[model samples]
Target: MRVTAVRTTRAPAWQWAGCAALVLLGAVIPVLRFLVFWPMDQWQVDVEVYRQAGVSILIGRPIYDAMTEAPQLLPFTYPPFAALLAIPLALLPFGLVGWLWTALQIAATTAIVWYAGYRLIHRGGSAQPLVLGLLAAPMFWLHPVGDGIRFGQVNAFIVLAALMDLRRPRPRVLSGVAPGVLVGLAMAIKLTPGVFVVHYVINRRWREAGTAIATAAIAWLAAFVAIPSASLAFWGGALQDPARLGPNMGTSNQSIRGVLMRVGPSGGAGVALWLVLIALVGWFGFRLARRAWLRGDTVTEVAAVGLLACLLSPVAWIHHFHWIVVAILAILGADPLRDRRRLVAALVITVWFVCRLPWWGISWIAHDWPPILVGRILQNADLAGALLALWLLAWASAREPRDAEADAVARAGERSAAPGKVERRAASEAG
Candidate 1:
C-alpha cells in the first residue's frame, strides 16, 4: 500500500512534466533561429508579395492593380479578400505586424498539430497521446513551419481551417462557408490550396464545394471591381510572362524545369513529367475516394484528398508539402496503435524529416561543401524530399480490400448491434 501510494504520487508529477515538455518543444520551432532573430525587413520572396498586397489594400488600390503595377509588386497572385485580410497588417509598421503575425501563426499551427496529434493518438477520444506524438514529430521541431512563422505565411491558418472542418460534421453555413472562404482566400493568395475545392467535390461535398467556389468567385470579383482594366492586364501578364521567365526565378523554385535545365533536357520533358505525375496521382486519389465513399469511410477520404492535392500540384514547396502532416495524422486518427502500420508510418515520416533537414539552413558538413556542390546537393535533396512526400502520400492512400471490407463490416455490426433500437425492442418484447 505504501509502494502504491508512492507510485501514484509520482505519476501526476511525471504527467505534468510530460505535458510541459510537449508544449515547449512544439513551440520551440517557431521561436528559434531565423524566426527568433530575423528582421521584418528581410522578408522572403512570398512575404514581400504579401506585404505589397497588404499595403495595396490599405491605400484603396485594388489588389489586382497592385499585383499588376509597373514595379510588379505583391506577387501574391491571390484573390481580393486576402489583400483585404492583410489590410489590418498594413496599418501597422512592418516590424510590429510581422512579429504579431508570426506569433499568431505559431500559436494557431501549434494548436492544429496539438489537436491533430490528439485525434490520431486517441482515435478522436482523449487527446493526451496526440499532444505527445505531435511533440515528437520532427516536423514539429525545426523547419519550414518556422520559416512560415518568420515570413508570416498563411499555411498554418490553412491547415487549421481544414483540420477544423474534418474534426467533425457540422451542418451550418459556417461549416460549409468557412472552409470555402478559407480555401478561396488561400487560392486567391497562393493559387495552390485551390486543390482543396477538388477535395471537397470528390468527397461528395457538392454543397460545400459550391460554397467554396462562390466565396472564391465573390472575392475575386471584389478585386476585379476595385481595379477593372488593371486586373485584366495583370491576368494577361501572368499568362504571358511564364514562357519568357521560366526557372530564373530562384534557388527555391528548382522545379521540374530546374531539374531539366540542370540535366540538359528540354522544358517539354519537365512539363510532361509533371503532367504524368498529376494524372497518375489523380487516378490513385480517385480510386481511394471511390473506395472510401462506397464504404462510407470519411477519414480515409479526407486524407486521400489532401495527399493527392500535394502530389498533383506542379510547384509544391516544402511548406506546401506540410499538408501531408494532415494525411498522416488522419490515418493515425482513423486507425490507432496498430503496431505494424504505425511502424511503417513512422519510418516514412522519419525519411521525410531527414530529407527536409536542409530547409532549416542549420546544415552540418553538407553546407560546408563548395558552393557548386552545395547547390547540387540542395537541389537533389529538395527533389528527393518532394518525391519522399509524394511516396508517403501514395502509401498512406493505399487500401487493402480485406482491411477496408473488415472496417466496413465492423461499422455495420456496430449499427446493427447498437442499443435500444426498434429491432432490439421487438426482440426483447418477444423474449
Candidate 2:
C-alpha cells in the first residue's frame, strides 16, 4: 500500500493578472485620497479621537479620561484593552502614526484576501479563474475593506482572526488561541467584535470560546488594575450609555436600528422591533450553521456563519461588514462561477458599494429639491442599503453545504464510541 499527500495547485497567468489587478486597486486607494473633496474636518473626527486616546495612554492620564470634556465624546465606545493595543503606535508622532497604522491595515487586508484565496484554492481544487474570482470577489473589494481603509479602521484584523479559525482541526486547543487573542483585542478596541464571541459559543466551539472569554478577561483585568477609577467610571455610566447613544437601528447608525428609525421614530417600539428582528436572524443563522455542519460543509461555511451574525446584529456599521470578504472567499473555495448561486452572490457583493455612492455624491448633487427632503431620501437609501446587505447574507447562508471536515470528525467520534476502541482513544488522549 502507498500513501499520498494532496497539494492544491496554482492558477494560470490570466488569473495571476486578476489577482494583481485587485491588489493594485487595494494598494492605490490610500494614495488616491487627495483627489476626493470631502470635508477634511469630518475625516479628523474618528482619527483625532484615537490619536488623543493614544496620547492620553502615553501620558499618565487614565485610559478613559475624556479626550473631550464630555464623557460620551470619546469618538467610540470600547473596552480598556483597546487603549493598550494602541500603545505602541502612541510612541510615534500622530502624522507618522496614522500613516503607518493605515499602511499596516492595508497590508493586513491584502494578506487576508491572499490567504482567503489560498484557502479557497486549497479546498476547491479547481481552475485559476475560480481562484481569481475568489481573490477578487466584489464583496472582498468593496464595502468593508473600502470604507474601513478609507476611515483608517482596524476591522481587517478582526477579519483575519475569524478566517484563521475556520475549519480548524478538532482538538485544536492551541489553534484556537491566536484567534481568541485577536477576538479579545478586537473587542477591546470596539464592542462590536464581542458579538463574534457569542457566535462562537453558539457554534459549540467551546475551547476557542473559553479562550476568547479568558483572554478578554485577562486583558480587561490588566487595564482595570492599571486604571481602577476609569474602569469604575465606565461601568458606572455603562447602564445609561446605550439610551444616551440612541438606538443603532436609526439611519444615523447604519444598523438595523437605523433602518427602523428611518421608517419611524427610534423610540421604544423601534427598539422592540429591533430585538425581535435580531432574534429571528439569530435563529435562522443557527439553523443554517447546523444544516451546513451536519451536511458536511467545509471550513469556509464558518465565514458564511460570520456574515449571518453581522447582519443579525442591531448595530453593524458599513465598515463592520468587512467580514464579508472572508465569506465570499469561503463560497468561492466551495464552488466557482459554474455555481450560479455563487456567481450571483459575487455580483451582489460587487454592487454593494453603490449604496455609499449617494452619500459620496450628496455634496456634488446640488439639486433643486428641498434640503430636508434630500436628507430624508438619503436616510431612506441607507435603510434600503442595510436591508440589501442582510438579504445577501441570507442568500449565502442557504447555498450548498460544505462541511467535509466536520463530518469526518463526527465519523471519527462515532468510531471512538465503538467497543474495543480503547487504543484509538488512548492515542488521541496522548496527543
Candidate 3:
C-alpha cells in the first residue's frame, strides 16, 4: 500500500514534467521566429514561394515566371513536381498555412530525433517521453532547423524522409508505396536528394536505386503531364540556373563551390577549380559513407551522405545544414554519456552549429578587420565541419573490424536471391 501510494504521487509529477517538455519543444520555433530570425531572411519566404506556386497551378500562371510579390521577388526555383505538391498550401490562407507549416516542421524535427536518436531514447527506460522531448527541443533550435522554420523550407521533410528510407527500410506508405519511394519523391521535389540515389548505386542497392529512379521519373512525368510547359521549363534550363538560388558568395551559401566563389579565382578558372575539388570530395565522401555502412552505423552512414549533399550542392543555404542534427546524433552514437570524449565532441559540434559562425566570418570581412584570416575560416565553418566530420567518421569506422559473418550472409543471400522476385527483400535485410 505504501509503495503504491508513492508511485501514484509521482505519476502526476512525471506527467507534468513530460507535458512541460512537450511545450518547450513546441515553443522553440515560435520563440526563434520572433526573437531570432536573421536580418537576411524574410519570414517564411520559402513558404510564400510554395504557396504562390500552388496558386500558380490553380490560376494557370506559369510557375517559373511567377514571382512572390514585393521586394524579394523570389521565383519558384524548385522542380515542377514540387509545384504540384504545393497546390494544397495554395488552398489555405497564407497565415493559416504558415502556422500549419511551422507545426509540421516541429513534427518532422521530433520525428527525426525519434528515429536517429532512438538508441539514446531507448536507454531512458520509463523516462522516454522526457528524454525525447528534451532532446527534440535543442534540435529544433539548431541553426539549420531554426532556419527551416523561419523560411518555411522543405528540408526537414527531406531529411526525415531520407532518414526513414535508410533507417526503417521496410515500411510501406499509404498502404502501397515502398521503402525507396519517399527518397524518390524527395528527389523529384528538389534535385539535392539525388545524392541518396547515388548512395544506393555505389553500394549496389540496385533494386532500391531502380525503385527510386522509377519513382522520381513518375513524379516528374506526372508533373509533365499536368503542366507540360512548367515541366519543360524546369528540366530544359531552369534547373541549371544556380543564379536563381541566391548570391553564391554570400554567407548562407555554405557549399564548397560557394567558398571557392568567395575566395578562389573567378570565370573559367573558378569553374575548373570547383570541378577538381568536387570530384575529390565526391570520391572521399562516398568512401567514408560506405565505411559507416559497413560498420552497420546507419546514423553515420546517412549523416555522411547528407553532409555530402550539402557540401557538394551548388547553392546550399543555411537551412540545408539541418543535416547536422543527425550528424550530432551520430557523434553521440549509442552511448550518449558513458564516454567523456564523445559527449564533449557532440556538445562542441552542437554548440558550433547553433552559433552562426559563417555570418561572423562575413562580419569580419565586411568590417575590414585585421584578422581577416580568422573571419574567412569562420565564414566557411559549416563546410569545414562537414569535411572534418567525414574524416573523423571514416577514422572511427576504420578502428572496428568488418563483420565477416554478416558479409558472408549478405553474399549468400545475394546469390540465392538474384533473378528472384524476393531479391529486394533479401538484399535489403541482408545488409
Using lDDT, give the best candidate's number.
3
- Local distance difference test, each candidate: 0.52, 0.55, 0.76
Measure candidate 1: CA RMSD.
8.5
Candidate 3 structure lDDT:
0.76
Give the Å shift of residue 7 in candidate 3.
21
Please report, as a residue range, the 10-residue window in candidate 3 with the lowest summed lDDT. 1-10
Q: In terms of TM-score, which candidate is strongest?
A: 3
Q: What overall lDDT, based on C-alpha atoms, would model 2 receive against the true structure?
A: 0.55
lDDT tens digits by residue: candidate 3, 236-314: 8888887888787888898989999888999999999999998899999888777677656677778889989998888
Model 2 segments more than 4 A misplaced: 1-5, 8-22, 34-40, 68-76, 123-141, 167-181, 238-240, 243-252, 295-301, 312-314, 354-431
* Candidate 3 C-alpha error for residue 299, in Å: 1.3
Number of clashes recorded per candidate:
5, 14, 0
Enumerate residue pairs that collide in model 1. Answer: 78-188, 78-189, 79-188, 117-130, 118-130
Cα deviation of 390, candidate 3, in Å: 2.4
Instruction: Identify the superior model by lDDT, candidate 2 or candidate 3.
Output: 3
True-structure lDDT of candidate 1? 0.52
In order of lDDT, best first, we have 3, 2, 1
User: Once model 1 is optimally superposed onto the true structure by TM-score, how far is the C-alpha of residue 318 displaced, in angstroms?
Assistant: 2.0
Worst 10 residues of 2 by lDDT: 422-431
lDDT of 3 at 198: 96
Model 3 root mean square deviation, Cα atoms:
7.8
Q: What is the lDDT of residue 59 in candidate 2?
A: 78
